[model samples]
Target: MADGTWRPYRVLLGSRLRSQTTYRRSFAMDLLGSLSVGALEFGEIYVIFTNVDVLGELDFAAAALLFALATICFSLADMVVGHADRLPTYLRQGTLDAFLLRPLPVLAQLITSDLSLRRLGRTAAGVAVLGVTLPHTGITWSVTTVVLLVLTIVAGTAIFAALFVCAAAIQFWLVEGAEFANAFTYGGSYAAQYPASIFALPVRVLFTFVVPAAFIAYLPTLALLDLPGPPGLPSWLGWCSPVMAVVMWAVALTGWRAGLRHYTGAGS
Candidate 1:
């Protein structure tokens, strides 16, 4: 953690930011598109509630809270690690090989190469939803509630970021694995917006235990609302999101290192 170590990242990220902001109209359009996508995604929850008063155990307001939390976390995580999804294209174009020649770590270089400012629009949309629905969810305002909310957002972001990196790591072997990676990253985001109780047992277990997507929003929302979780998930499980994030990072880093070792370069 020396300044020297961070200097390269600062330069790279700074340039990326400047480039993104250089065109005002383009940046604004990007934000609008991103915000529209965020709104449309939440529209799925809204549509379901329009037809029925409840989804699983959640009413419309409660479901909105869940969507906001999950969307915010997923958007923030995507801003950071979403570029890693280009691993296949980088491998094919020899961009990753050039990164290997740089003084910085490959992962660090990849991350700093392009910072997506547009994802902030999605984050903003989530904040809007949270602002609108939070009071209606019957969450008590307390120091502990505030702390849990903050922790949930931070932990959820980490969980999703790790998933992105881990999924990208698979591309070292399967150069055509973008869809496979999307299944966990984007697909996980889509699944996290709803109540886990609505899914079948097998799907619920897969997301909860294997992918830990439930920790991103569902369990945390239940904890915030002081409601009991359905069948297998306990309300207290929400507090375990930080632990889950740590475990996920461990898996992601291990897979990343193994992928690096396995990589033979673009020529191979």
Candidate 2:
């Protein structure tokens, strides 16, 4: 219960990373596959942009930075907490018993159990793309801009992780994995990879209110890129992503605790 007790979490994360590294060949193949898939995704965007000069005031470099930011954040979240999304299977097979026996927090145990190294491939490529596109995009970089960009990435990761946690908690009531929830997880990532203003009003509202993803991806990109937002959106919205991430994580944690109680009572 001590606030300083991070050693156990470190051990758990190390074990998972080591297990992933053990299968070197498979890890390499997975890395290559992830890179290929990421490239193909960008390729489709490029094909779209060839005919269209701008997608809602965002040029190619600006759009590429959006993709880079979203990819890095999502990859980090998937690598850190990918196992949380598998809780339904673990619960059904009584694997939750092992987790319950542990003294650490359930969320901590869930996160450190699996390390998706394949996502590392995506993260690396995303950083590379960001580096390449950032200079071309004409964003005036200052000390503050650099700090805000770092915050944006951290906030984006937290937001996506919170979504994954909530989706995992819903498994307790649904008693199965829910693909529909993935619209917020994977679909949100895909949506953030482009300019949110390009999407329809309904989609924009869903990301803004229901999921708060626009704060993580769109608003921050607007500030970073110095691009004009759609009507009525304030310029200060960009700086609020990190705060929104904390709020979302807090809500997800509460839901997770309630779900655990439900699971214990149902004996399922």
Candidate 3:
């Protein structure tokens, strides 16, 4: 936490940022592409609203808030920890062993190794949705509401970042398990964008309790809008986002430590 302790990481991330920006044209195109994908993802909800007045008890504006919260959180998490997906490659190349020899923590080294500047485009798109929808959701703004909104973003990001780390840690065992991990990390993002009420009991349990995706957006949106959640999920559950984030990080770190102990390096 000390300034000097983080100086090395700052230097590493600074170099990565500079390397990414070195090619202006490529970086711009990457940004535009990321933005376009975000727009198209939101367009699905927009199109849905065109046909239905409400989906999962949420009107267009309310739904937009749901989408924006999930998108911003997921996009930010992906920008920060998405590269953990490369753990398998690092293992194959023996780069992970090199990390073990370094003074920095392995996870910190991995997280600070690269910075995805282009994902900011997705974050921008999410911010745009939030701006347009928050005022129209018709919710009375209070200090609590403001704090909840900020907490939703922070906790949601933590939930997703922990998910990425969890998946990466599992890769220490599965080796070629990117697809399997994506089922949670990326799949959780996909699920978060929609309301939990839209899902059946099994899926609701899966995303809500197992994956904890529901806490990322749906439950918080319900709390913010003062709406009741469907059977088994109460509005008060939204306030548990921080708790869920802590639980997820705990799980992720445990898996990471176990995987590290299990790993015998690429040669083995």
Candidate 4:
């Protein structure tokens, strides 16, 4: 974030943007594909909830609130960290060694390698969903709630991005376990699209304490929903989202550093 770094950062990002924009036809297809996939995921929730008034204690709008928030957060994270998905492939091809030789930060180079404009389309869809559902969800709108909403989105984005970073870093040691890391990255996003109360207590606890997925949307949505906490759950958990985000980010960065330290280098 130095004043000197801005020029290089812009150069790297703008170069990728120009190259990615060159494929107009492919870009259009990717944009539509990303948007449609999000639509289908939300549609599944709609169809399931229509037959029943509530899943646990959450109504359709409440659940949709969670979905919209999760979608927006995940979409933003994907645009920034989606390139991390290919780190393992680069390792296998020795392209990672080339990255280490670059003058820029390794993470920044990896991120700028691909910006993935298609994610912006998905983010637009999420914004539309949020605009539609928010008015009907009966939130007692206030400046504090609004601030909480924005912070929740920012924090959620950071948490998801960190998850991607951790997953990529794991490739340093286990090339074959990309799928294992993905189970948490993608699976965590998928799981967050619903009310936390809907999942069993064990799963809820794992996401909350281990992967920290619940803070991305579910817990924050609950606080904003103007609803009571499920069973014996504390009402304050909703306000704890920013804290959870900070904690998860620290953990993920630590994991990334540890992985970098253990990296055996190309052809190891």
Candidate 5:
């Protein structure tokens, strides 16, 4: 809230941006790889759709928009906290001790340690797709719709980031269980890229009630698309993804702190 507090966050973000730019060649390679991979994935989806009229209520364009939104959100989260995802490995290998000695906040230090330049291309591709497809989706665009879209994207990013933080926290106990955590992180992203209701009822309930992932993509998309949601779910619920994100993040922070305490005791 204070001017003094803002400077450190700004400096940290600037340093990361500079660091990413410093490796121009590697960054370029990463960018190209990311773009190619995204294109290939989308191409497959397009090919599959030639035989089917729709996946549930989502037509091709709607599905593409969902994919684009999910990809962009995931890429942004990956860019911000990619290193945190690797914290389990670092802790197990004793490399995290070095980070503990640093004067910065543990969360900040963990986040800034690694950056994935490849995700920049993915993020770019997502934005490009959304720009091309949104106009054709039949949703009347107004200032209010535009604002909602921006908020939805922000919420998606926060939700993914919170998932990553929770995954990292789980690693403290099941150091080798990071693979399981990916079920939520990567699997959830994949699911969110589609219409959530297309999934079975049990799976839908898990994402909605347990992980709260439905709020990130499906609910918001439903609002933006002006579609009917499941019974008892309100249109206003779509707007709450960002709030859910904040709550998830707070829970993850508490878990992470507890993990750190456990780790320190074990190391001693």
Candidate 6:
């Protein structure tokens, strides 16, 4: 929490980057592989729209733009935020002992313990998709829209990161965590890519009320295009991505604190 905490983080970040660069060819392939996976996902969207002009009442470009926005925002989050996913492994291997001895918070150490630079490939892919689709959306260019767009993306990233924290927090109680949290972290990202309307009522409810992923890009996307929120949601909710982000973060942090307190390593 102190300003000094960042000093350690900076040192660790630099060291990790340098070490990762040692395998430049491996890194390049990892990056390219991630990008290819993203492209293939988007390619499926293209194929779907080719059969019909619209799915979920939005045209192909609009839907793709929404998908791209989620992609960009989630990719940004995963690039660094996904680093939290390693907490369980550390706990199981007793590697977390070193973190407890450090002056910095264990969460801080765990966050930077492993940085997968390869995920940046997904971010690049999202940016490429947005670049191609932005010109066709026909959304009027304005300062407010731009600001809202930025906020939407930022809030989206925070929401995704917070989800990671919650997912990782559970590891404190269950050290041998499998892909349990994937149902929300990864699943939420996949569901968020397109309009929520396409999903069943139960899914919409689950993601919206339970996971709050609808704010990541679904409602924000609608708000960006000056469209209305889906049935069962308040009309003004789409524009409240920042508020949603804050609320979700509060919940995730509370869970994290509780989990940390409950945590007693294998030695205990």
TM-score against truth, every candidate: 0.98, 0.94, 0.98, 0.95, 0.91, 0.94
lDDT (10s digit) by residue, model 6, range 135-245: 898878899779978998898998898899989888788777548988899999988887888878998999887887788877876777777666886546767888878
Off by over 4 Å in 4: none
| Clash numbers, per candidate | 0, 0, 0, 0, 0, 0
Worst 10 residues of 4 by lDDT: 226-235
What candidate 6 gets wrong by more than 4 Å, as runs, is 1-5
Candidate 6 lDDT score relative to the true structure: 0.83
Query: Model 5: per-residue lDDT, tens digit, 102-189?
Result: 6777877778666666688889888888888888788878887788899989988999998888888888888877788899888877
> How big is the positional error of residue 130 in model 1, measured in Å on the Cα after superposition?
0.4
Output the lDDT of residue 231, model 3.
90
The better-scoring model by lDDT among 3 and 6 is 3
Ranked by TM-score, the better of candidates 2 and 4 is 4
What is the lDDT of every predicted structure here? 0.92, 0.83, 0.95, 0.84, 0.80, 0.83
Expressed as tens digits, the lDDT of each residue in 68-156 for candidate 1 is: 99999999999998889888998888778888887878988888878899999999999999999988998899999999999999999
Q: What is the C-alpha RMSD of each candidate to the true structure, in Å?
A: 1.1, 1.9, 1.1, 1.6, 2.3, 1.8
Q: How are the candidates ranked when ordered by lDDT, highest leading? A: 3, 1, 4, 2, 6, 5
Residue pairs that clash (backbone atoms under 3 angstroms), model 2: none
Candidate 4, residues 1-268: lDDT per residue as tens digits?
Answer: 5868788888888998898889999989988899988898889888998799888688888888888999999999999997798988888787888888889878888888988888988888788889999998999989989988998899899889988988888888888678988888999898878777777889878877788788888878888876777764555687787787788778877877787777767784
The C-alpha stretches of model 5 lying farther than 4 A from their native spots are 1-16, 232-235, 265-268
Q: Choose the strongest candidate by lDDT.
A: 3
lDDT at residue 173 of model 5 (Cα atoms):
86
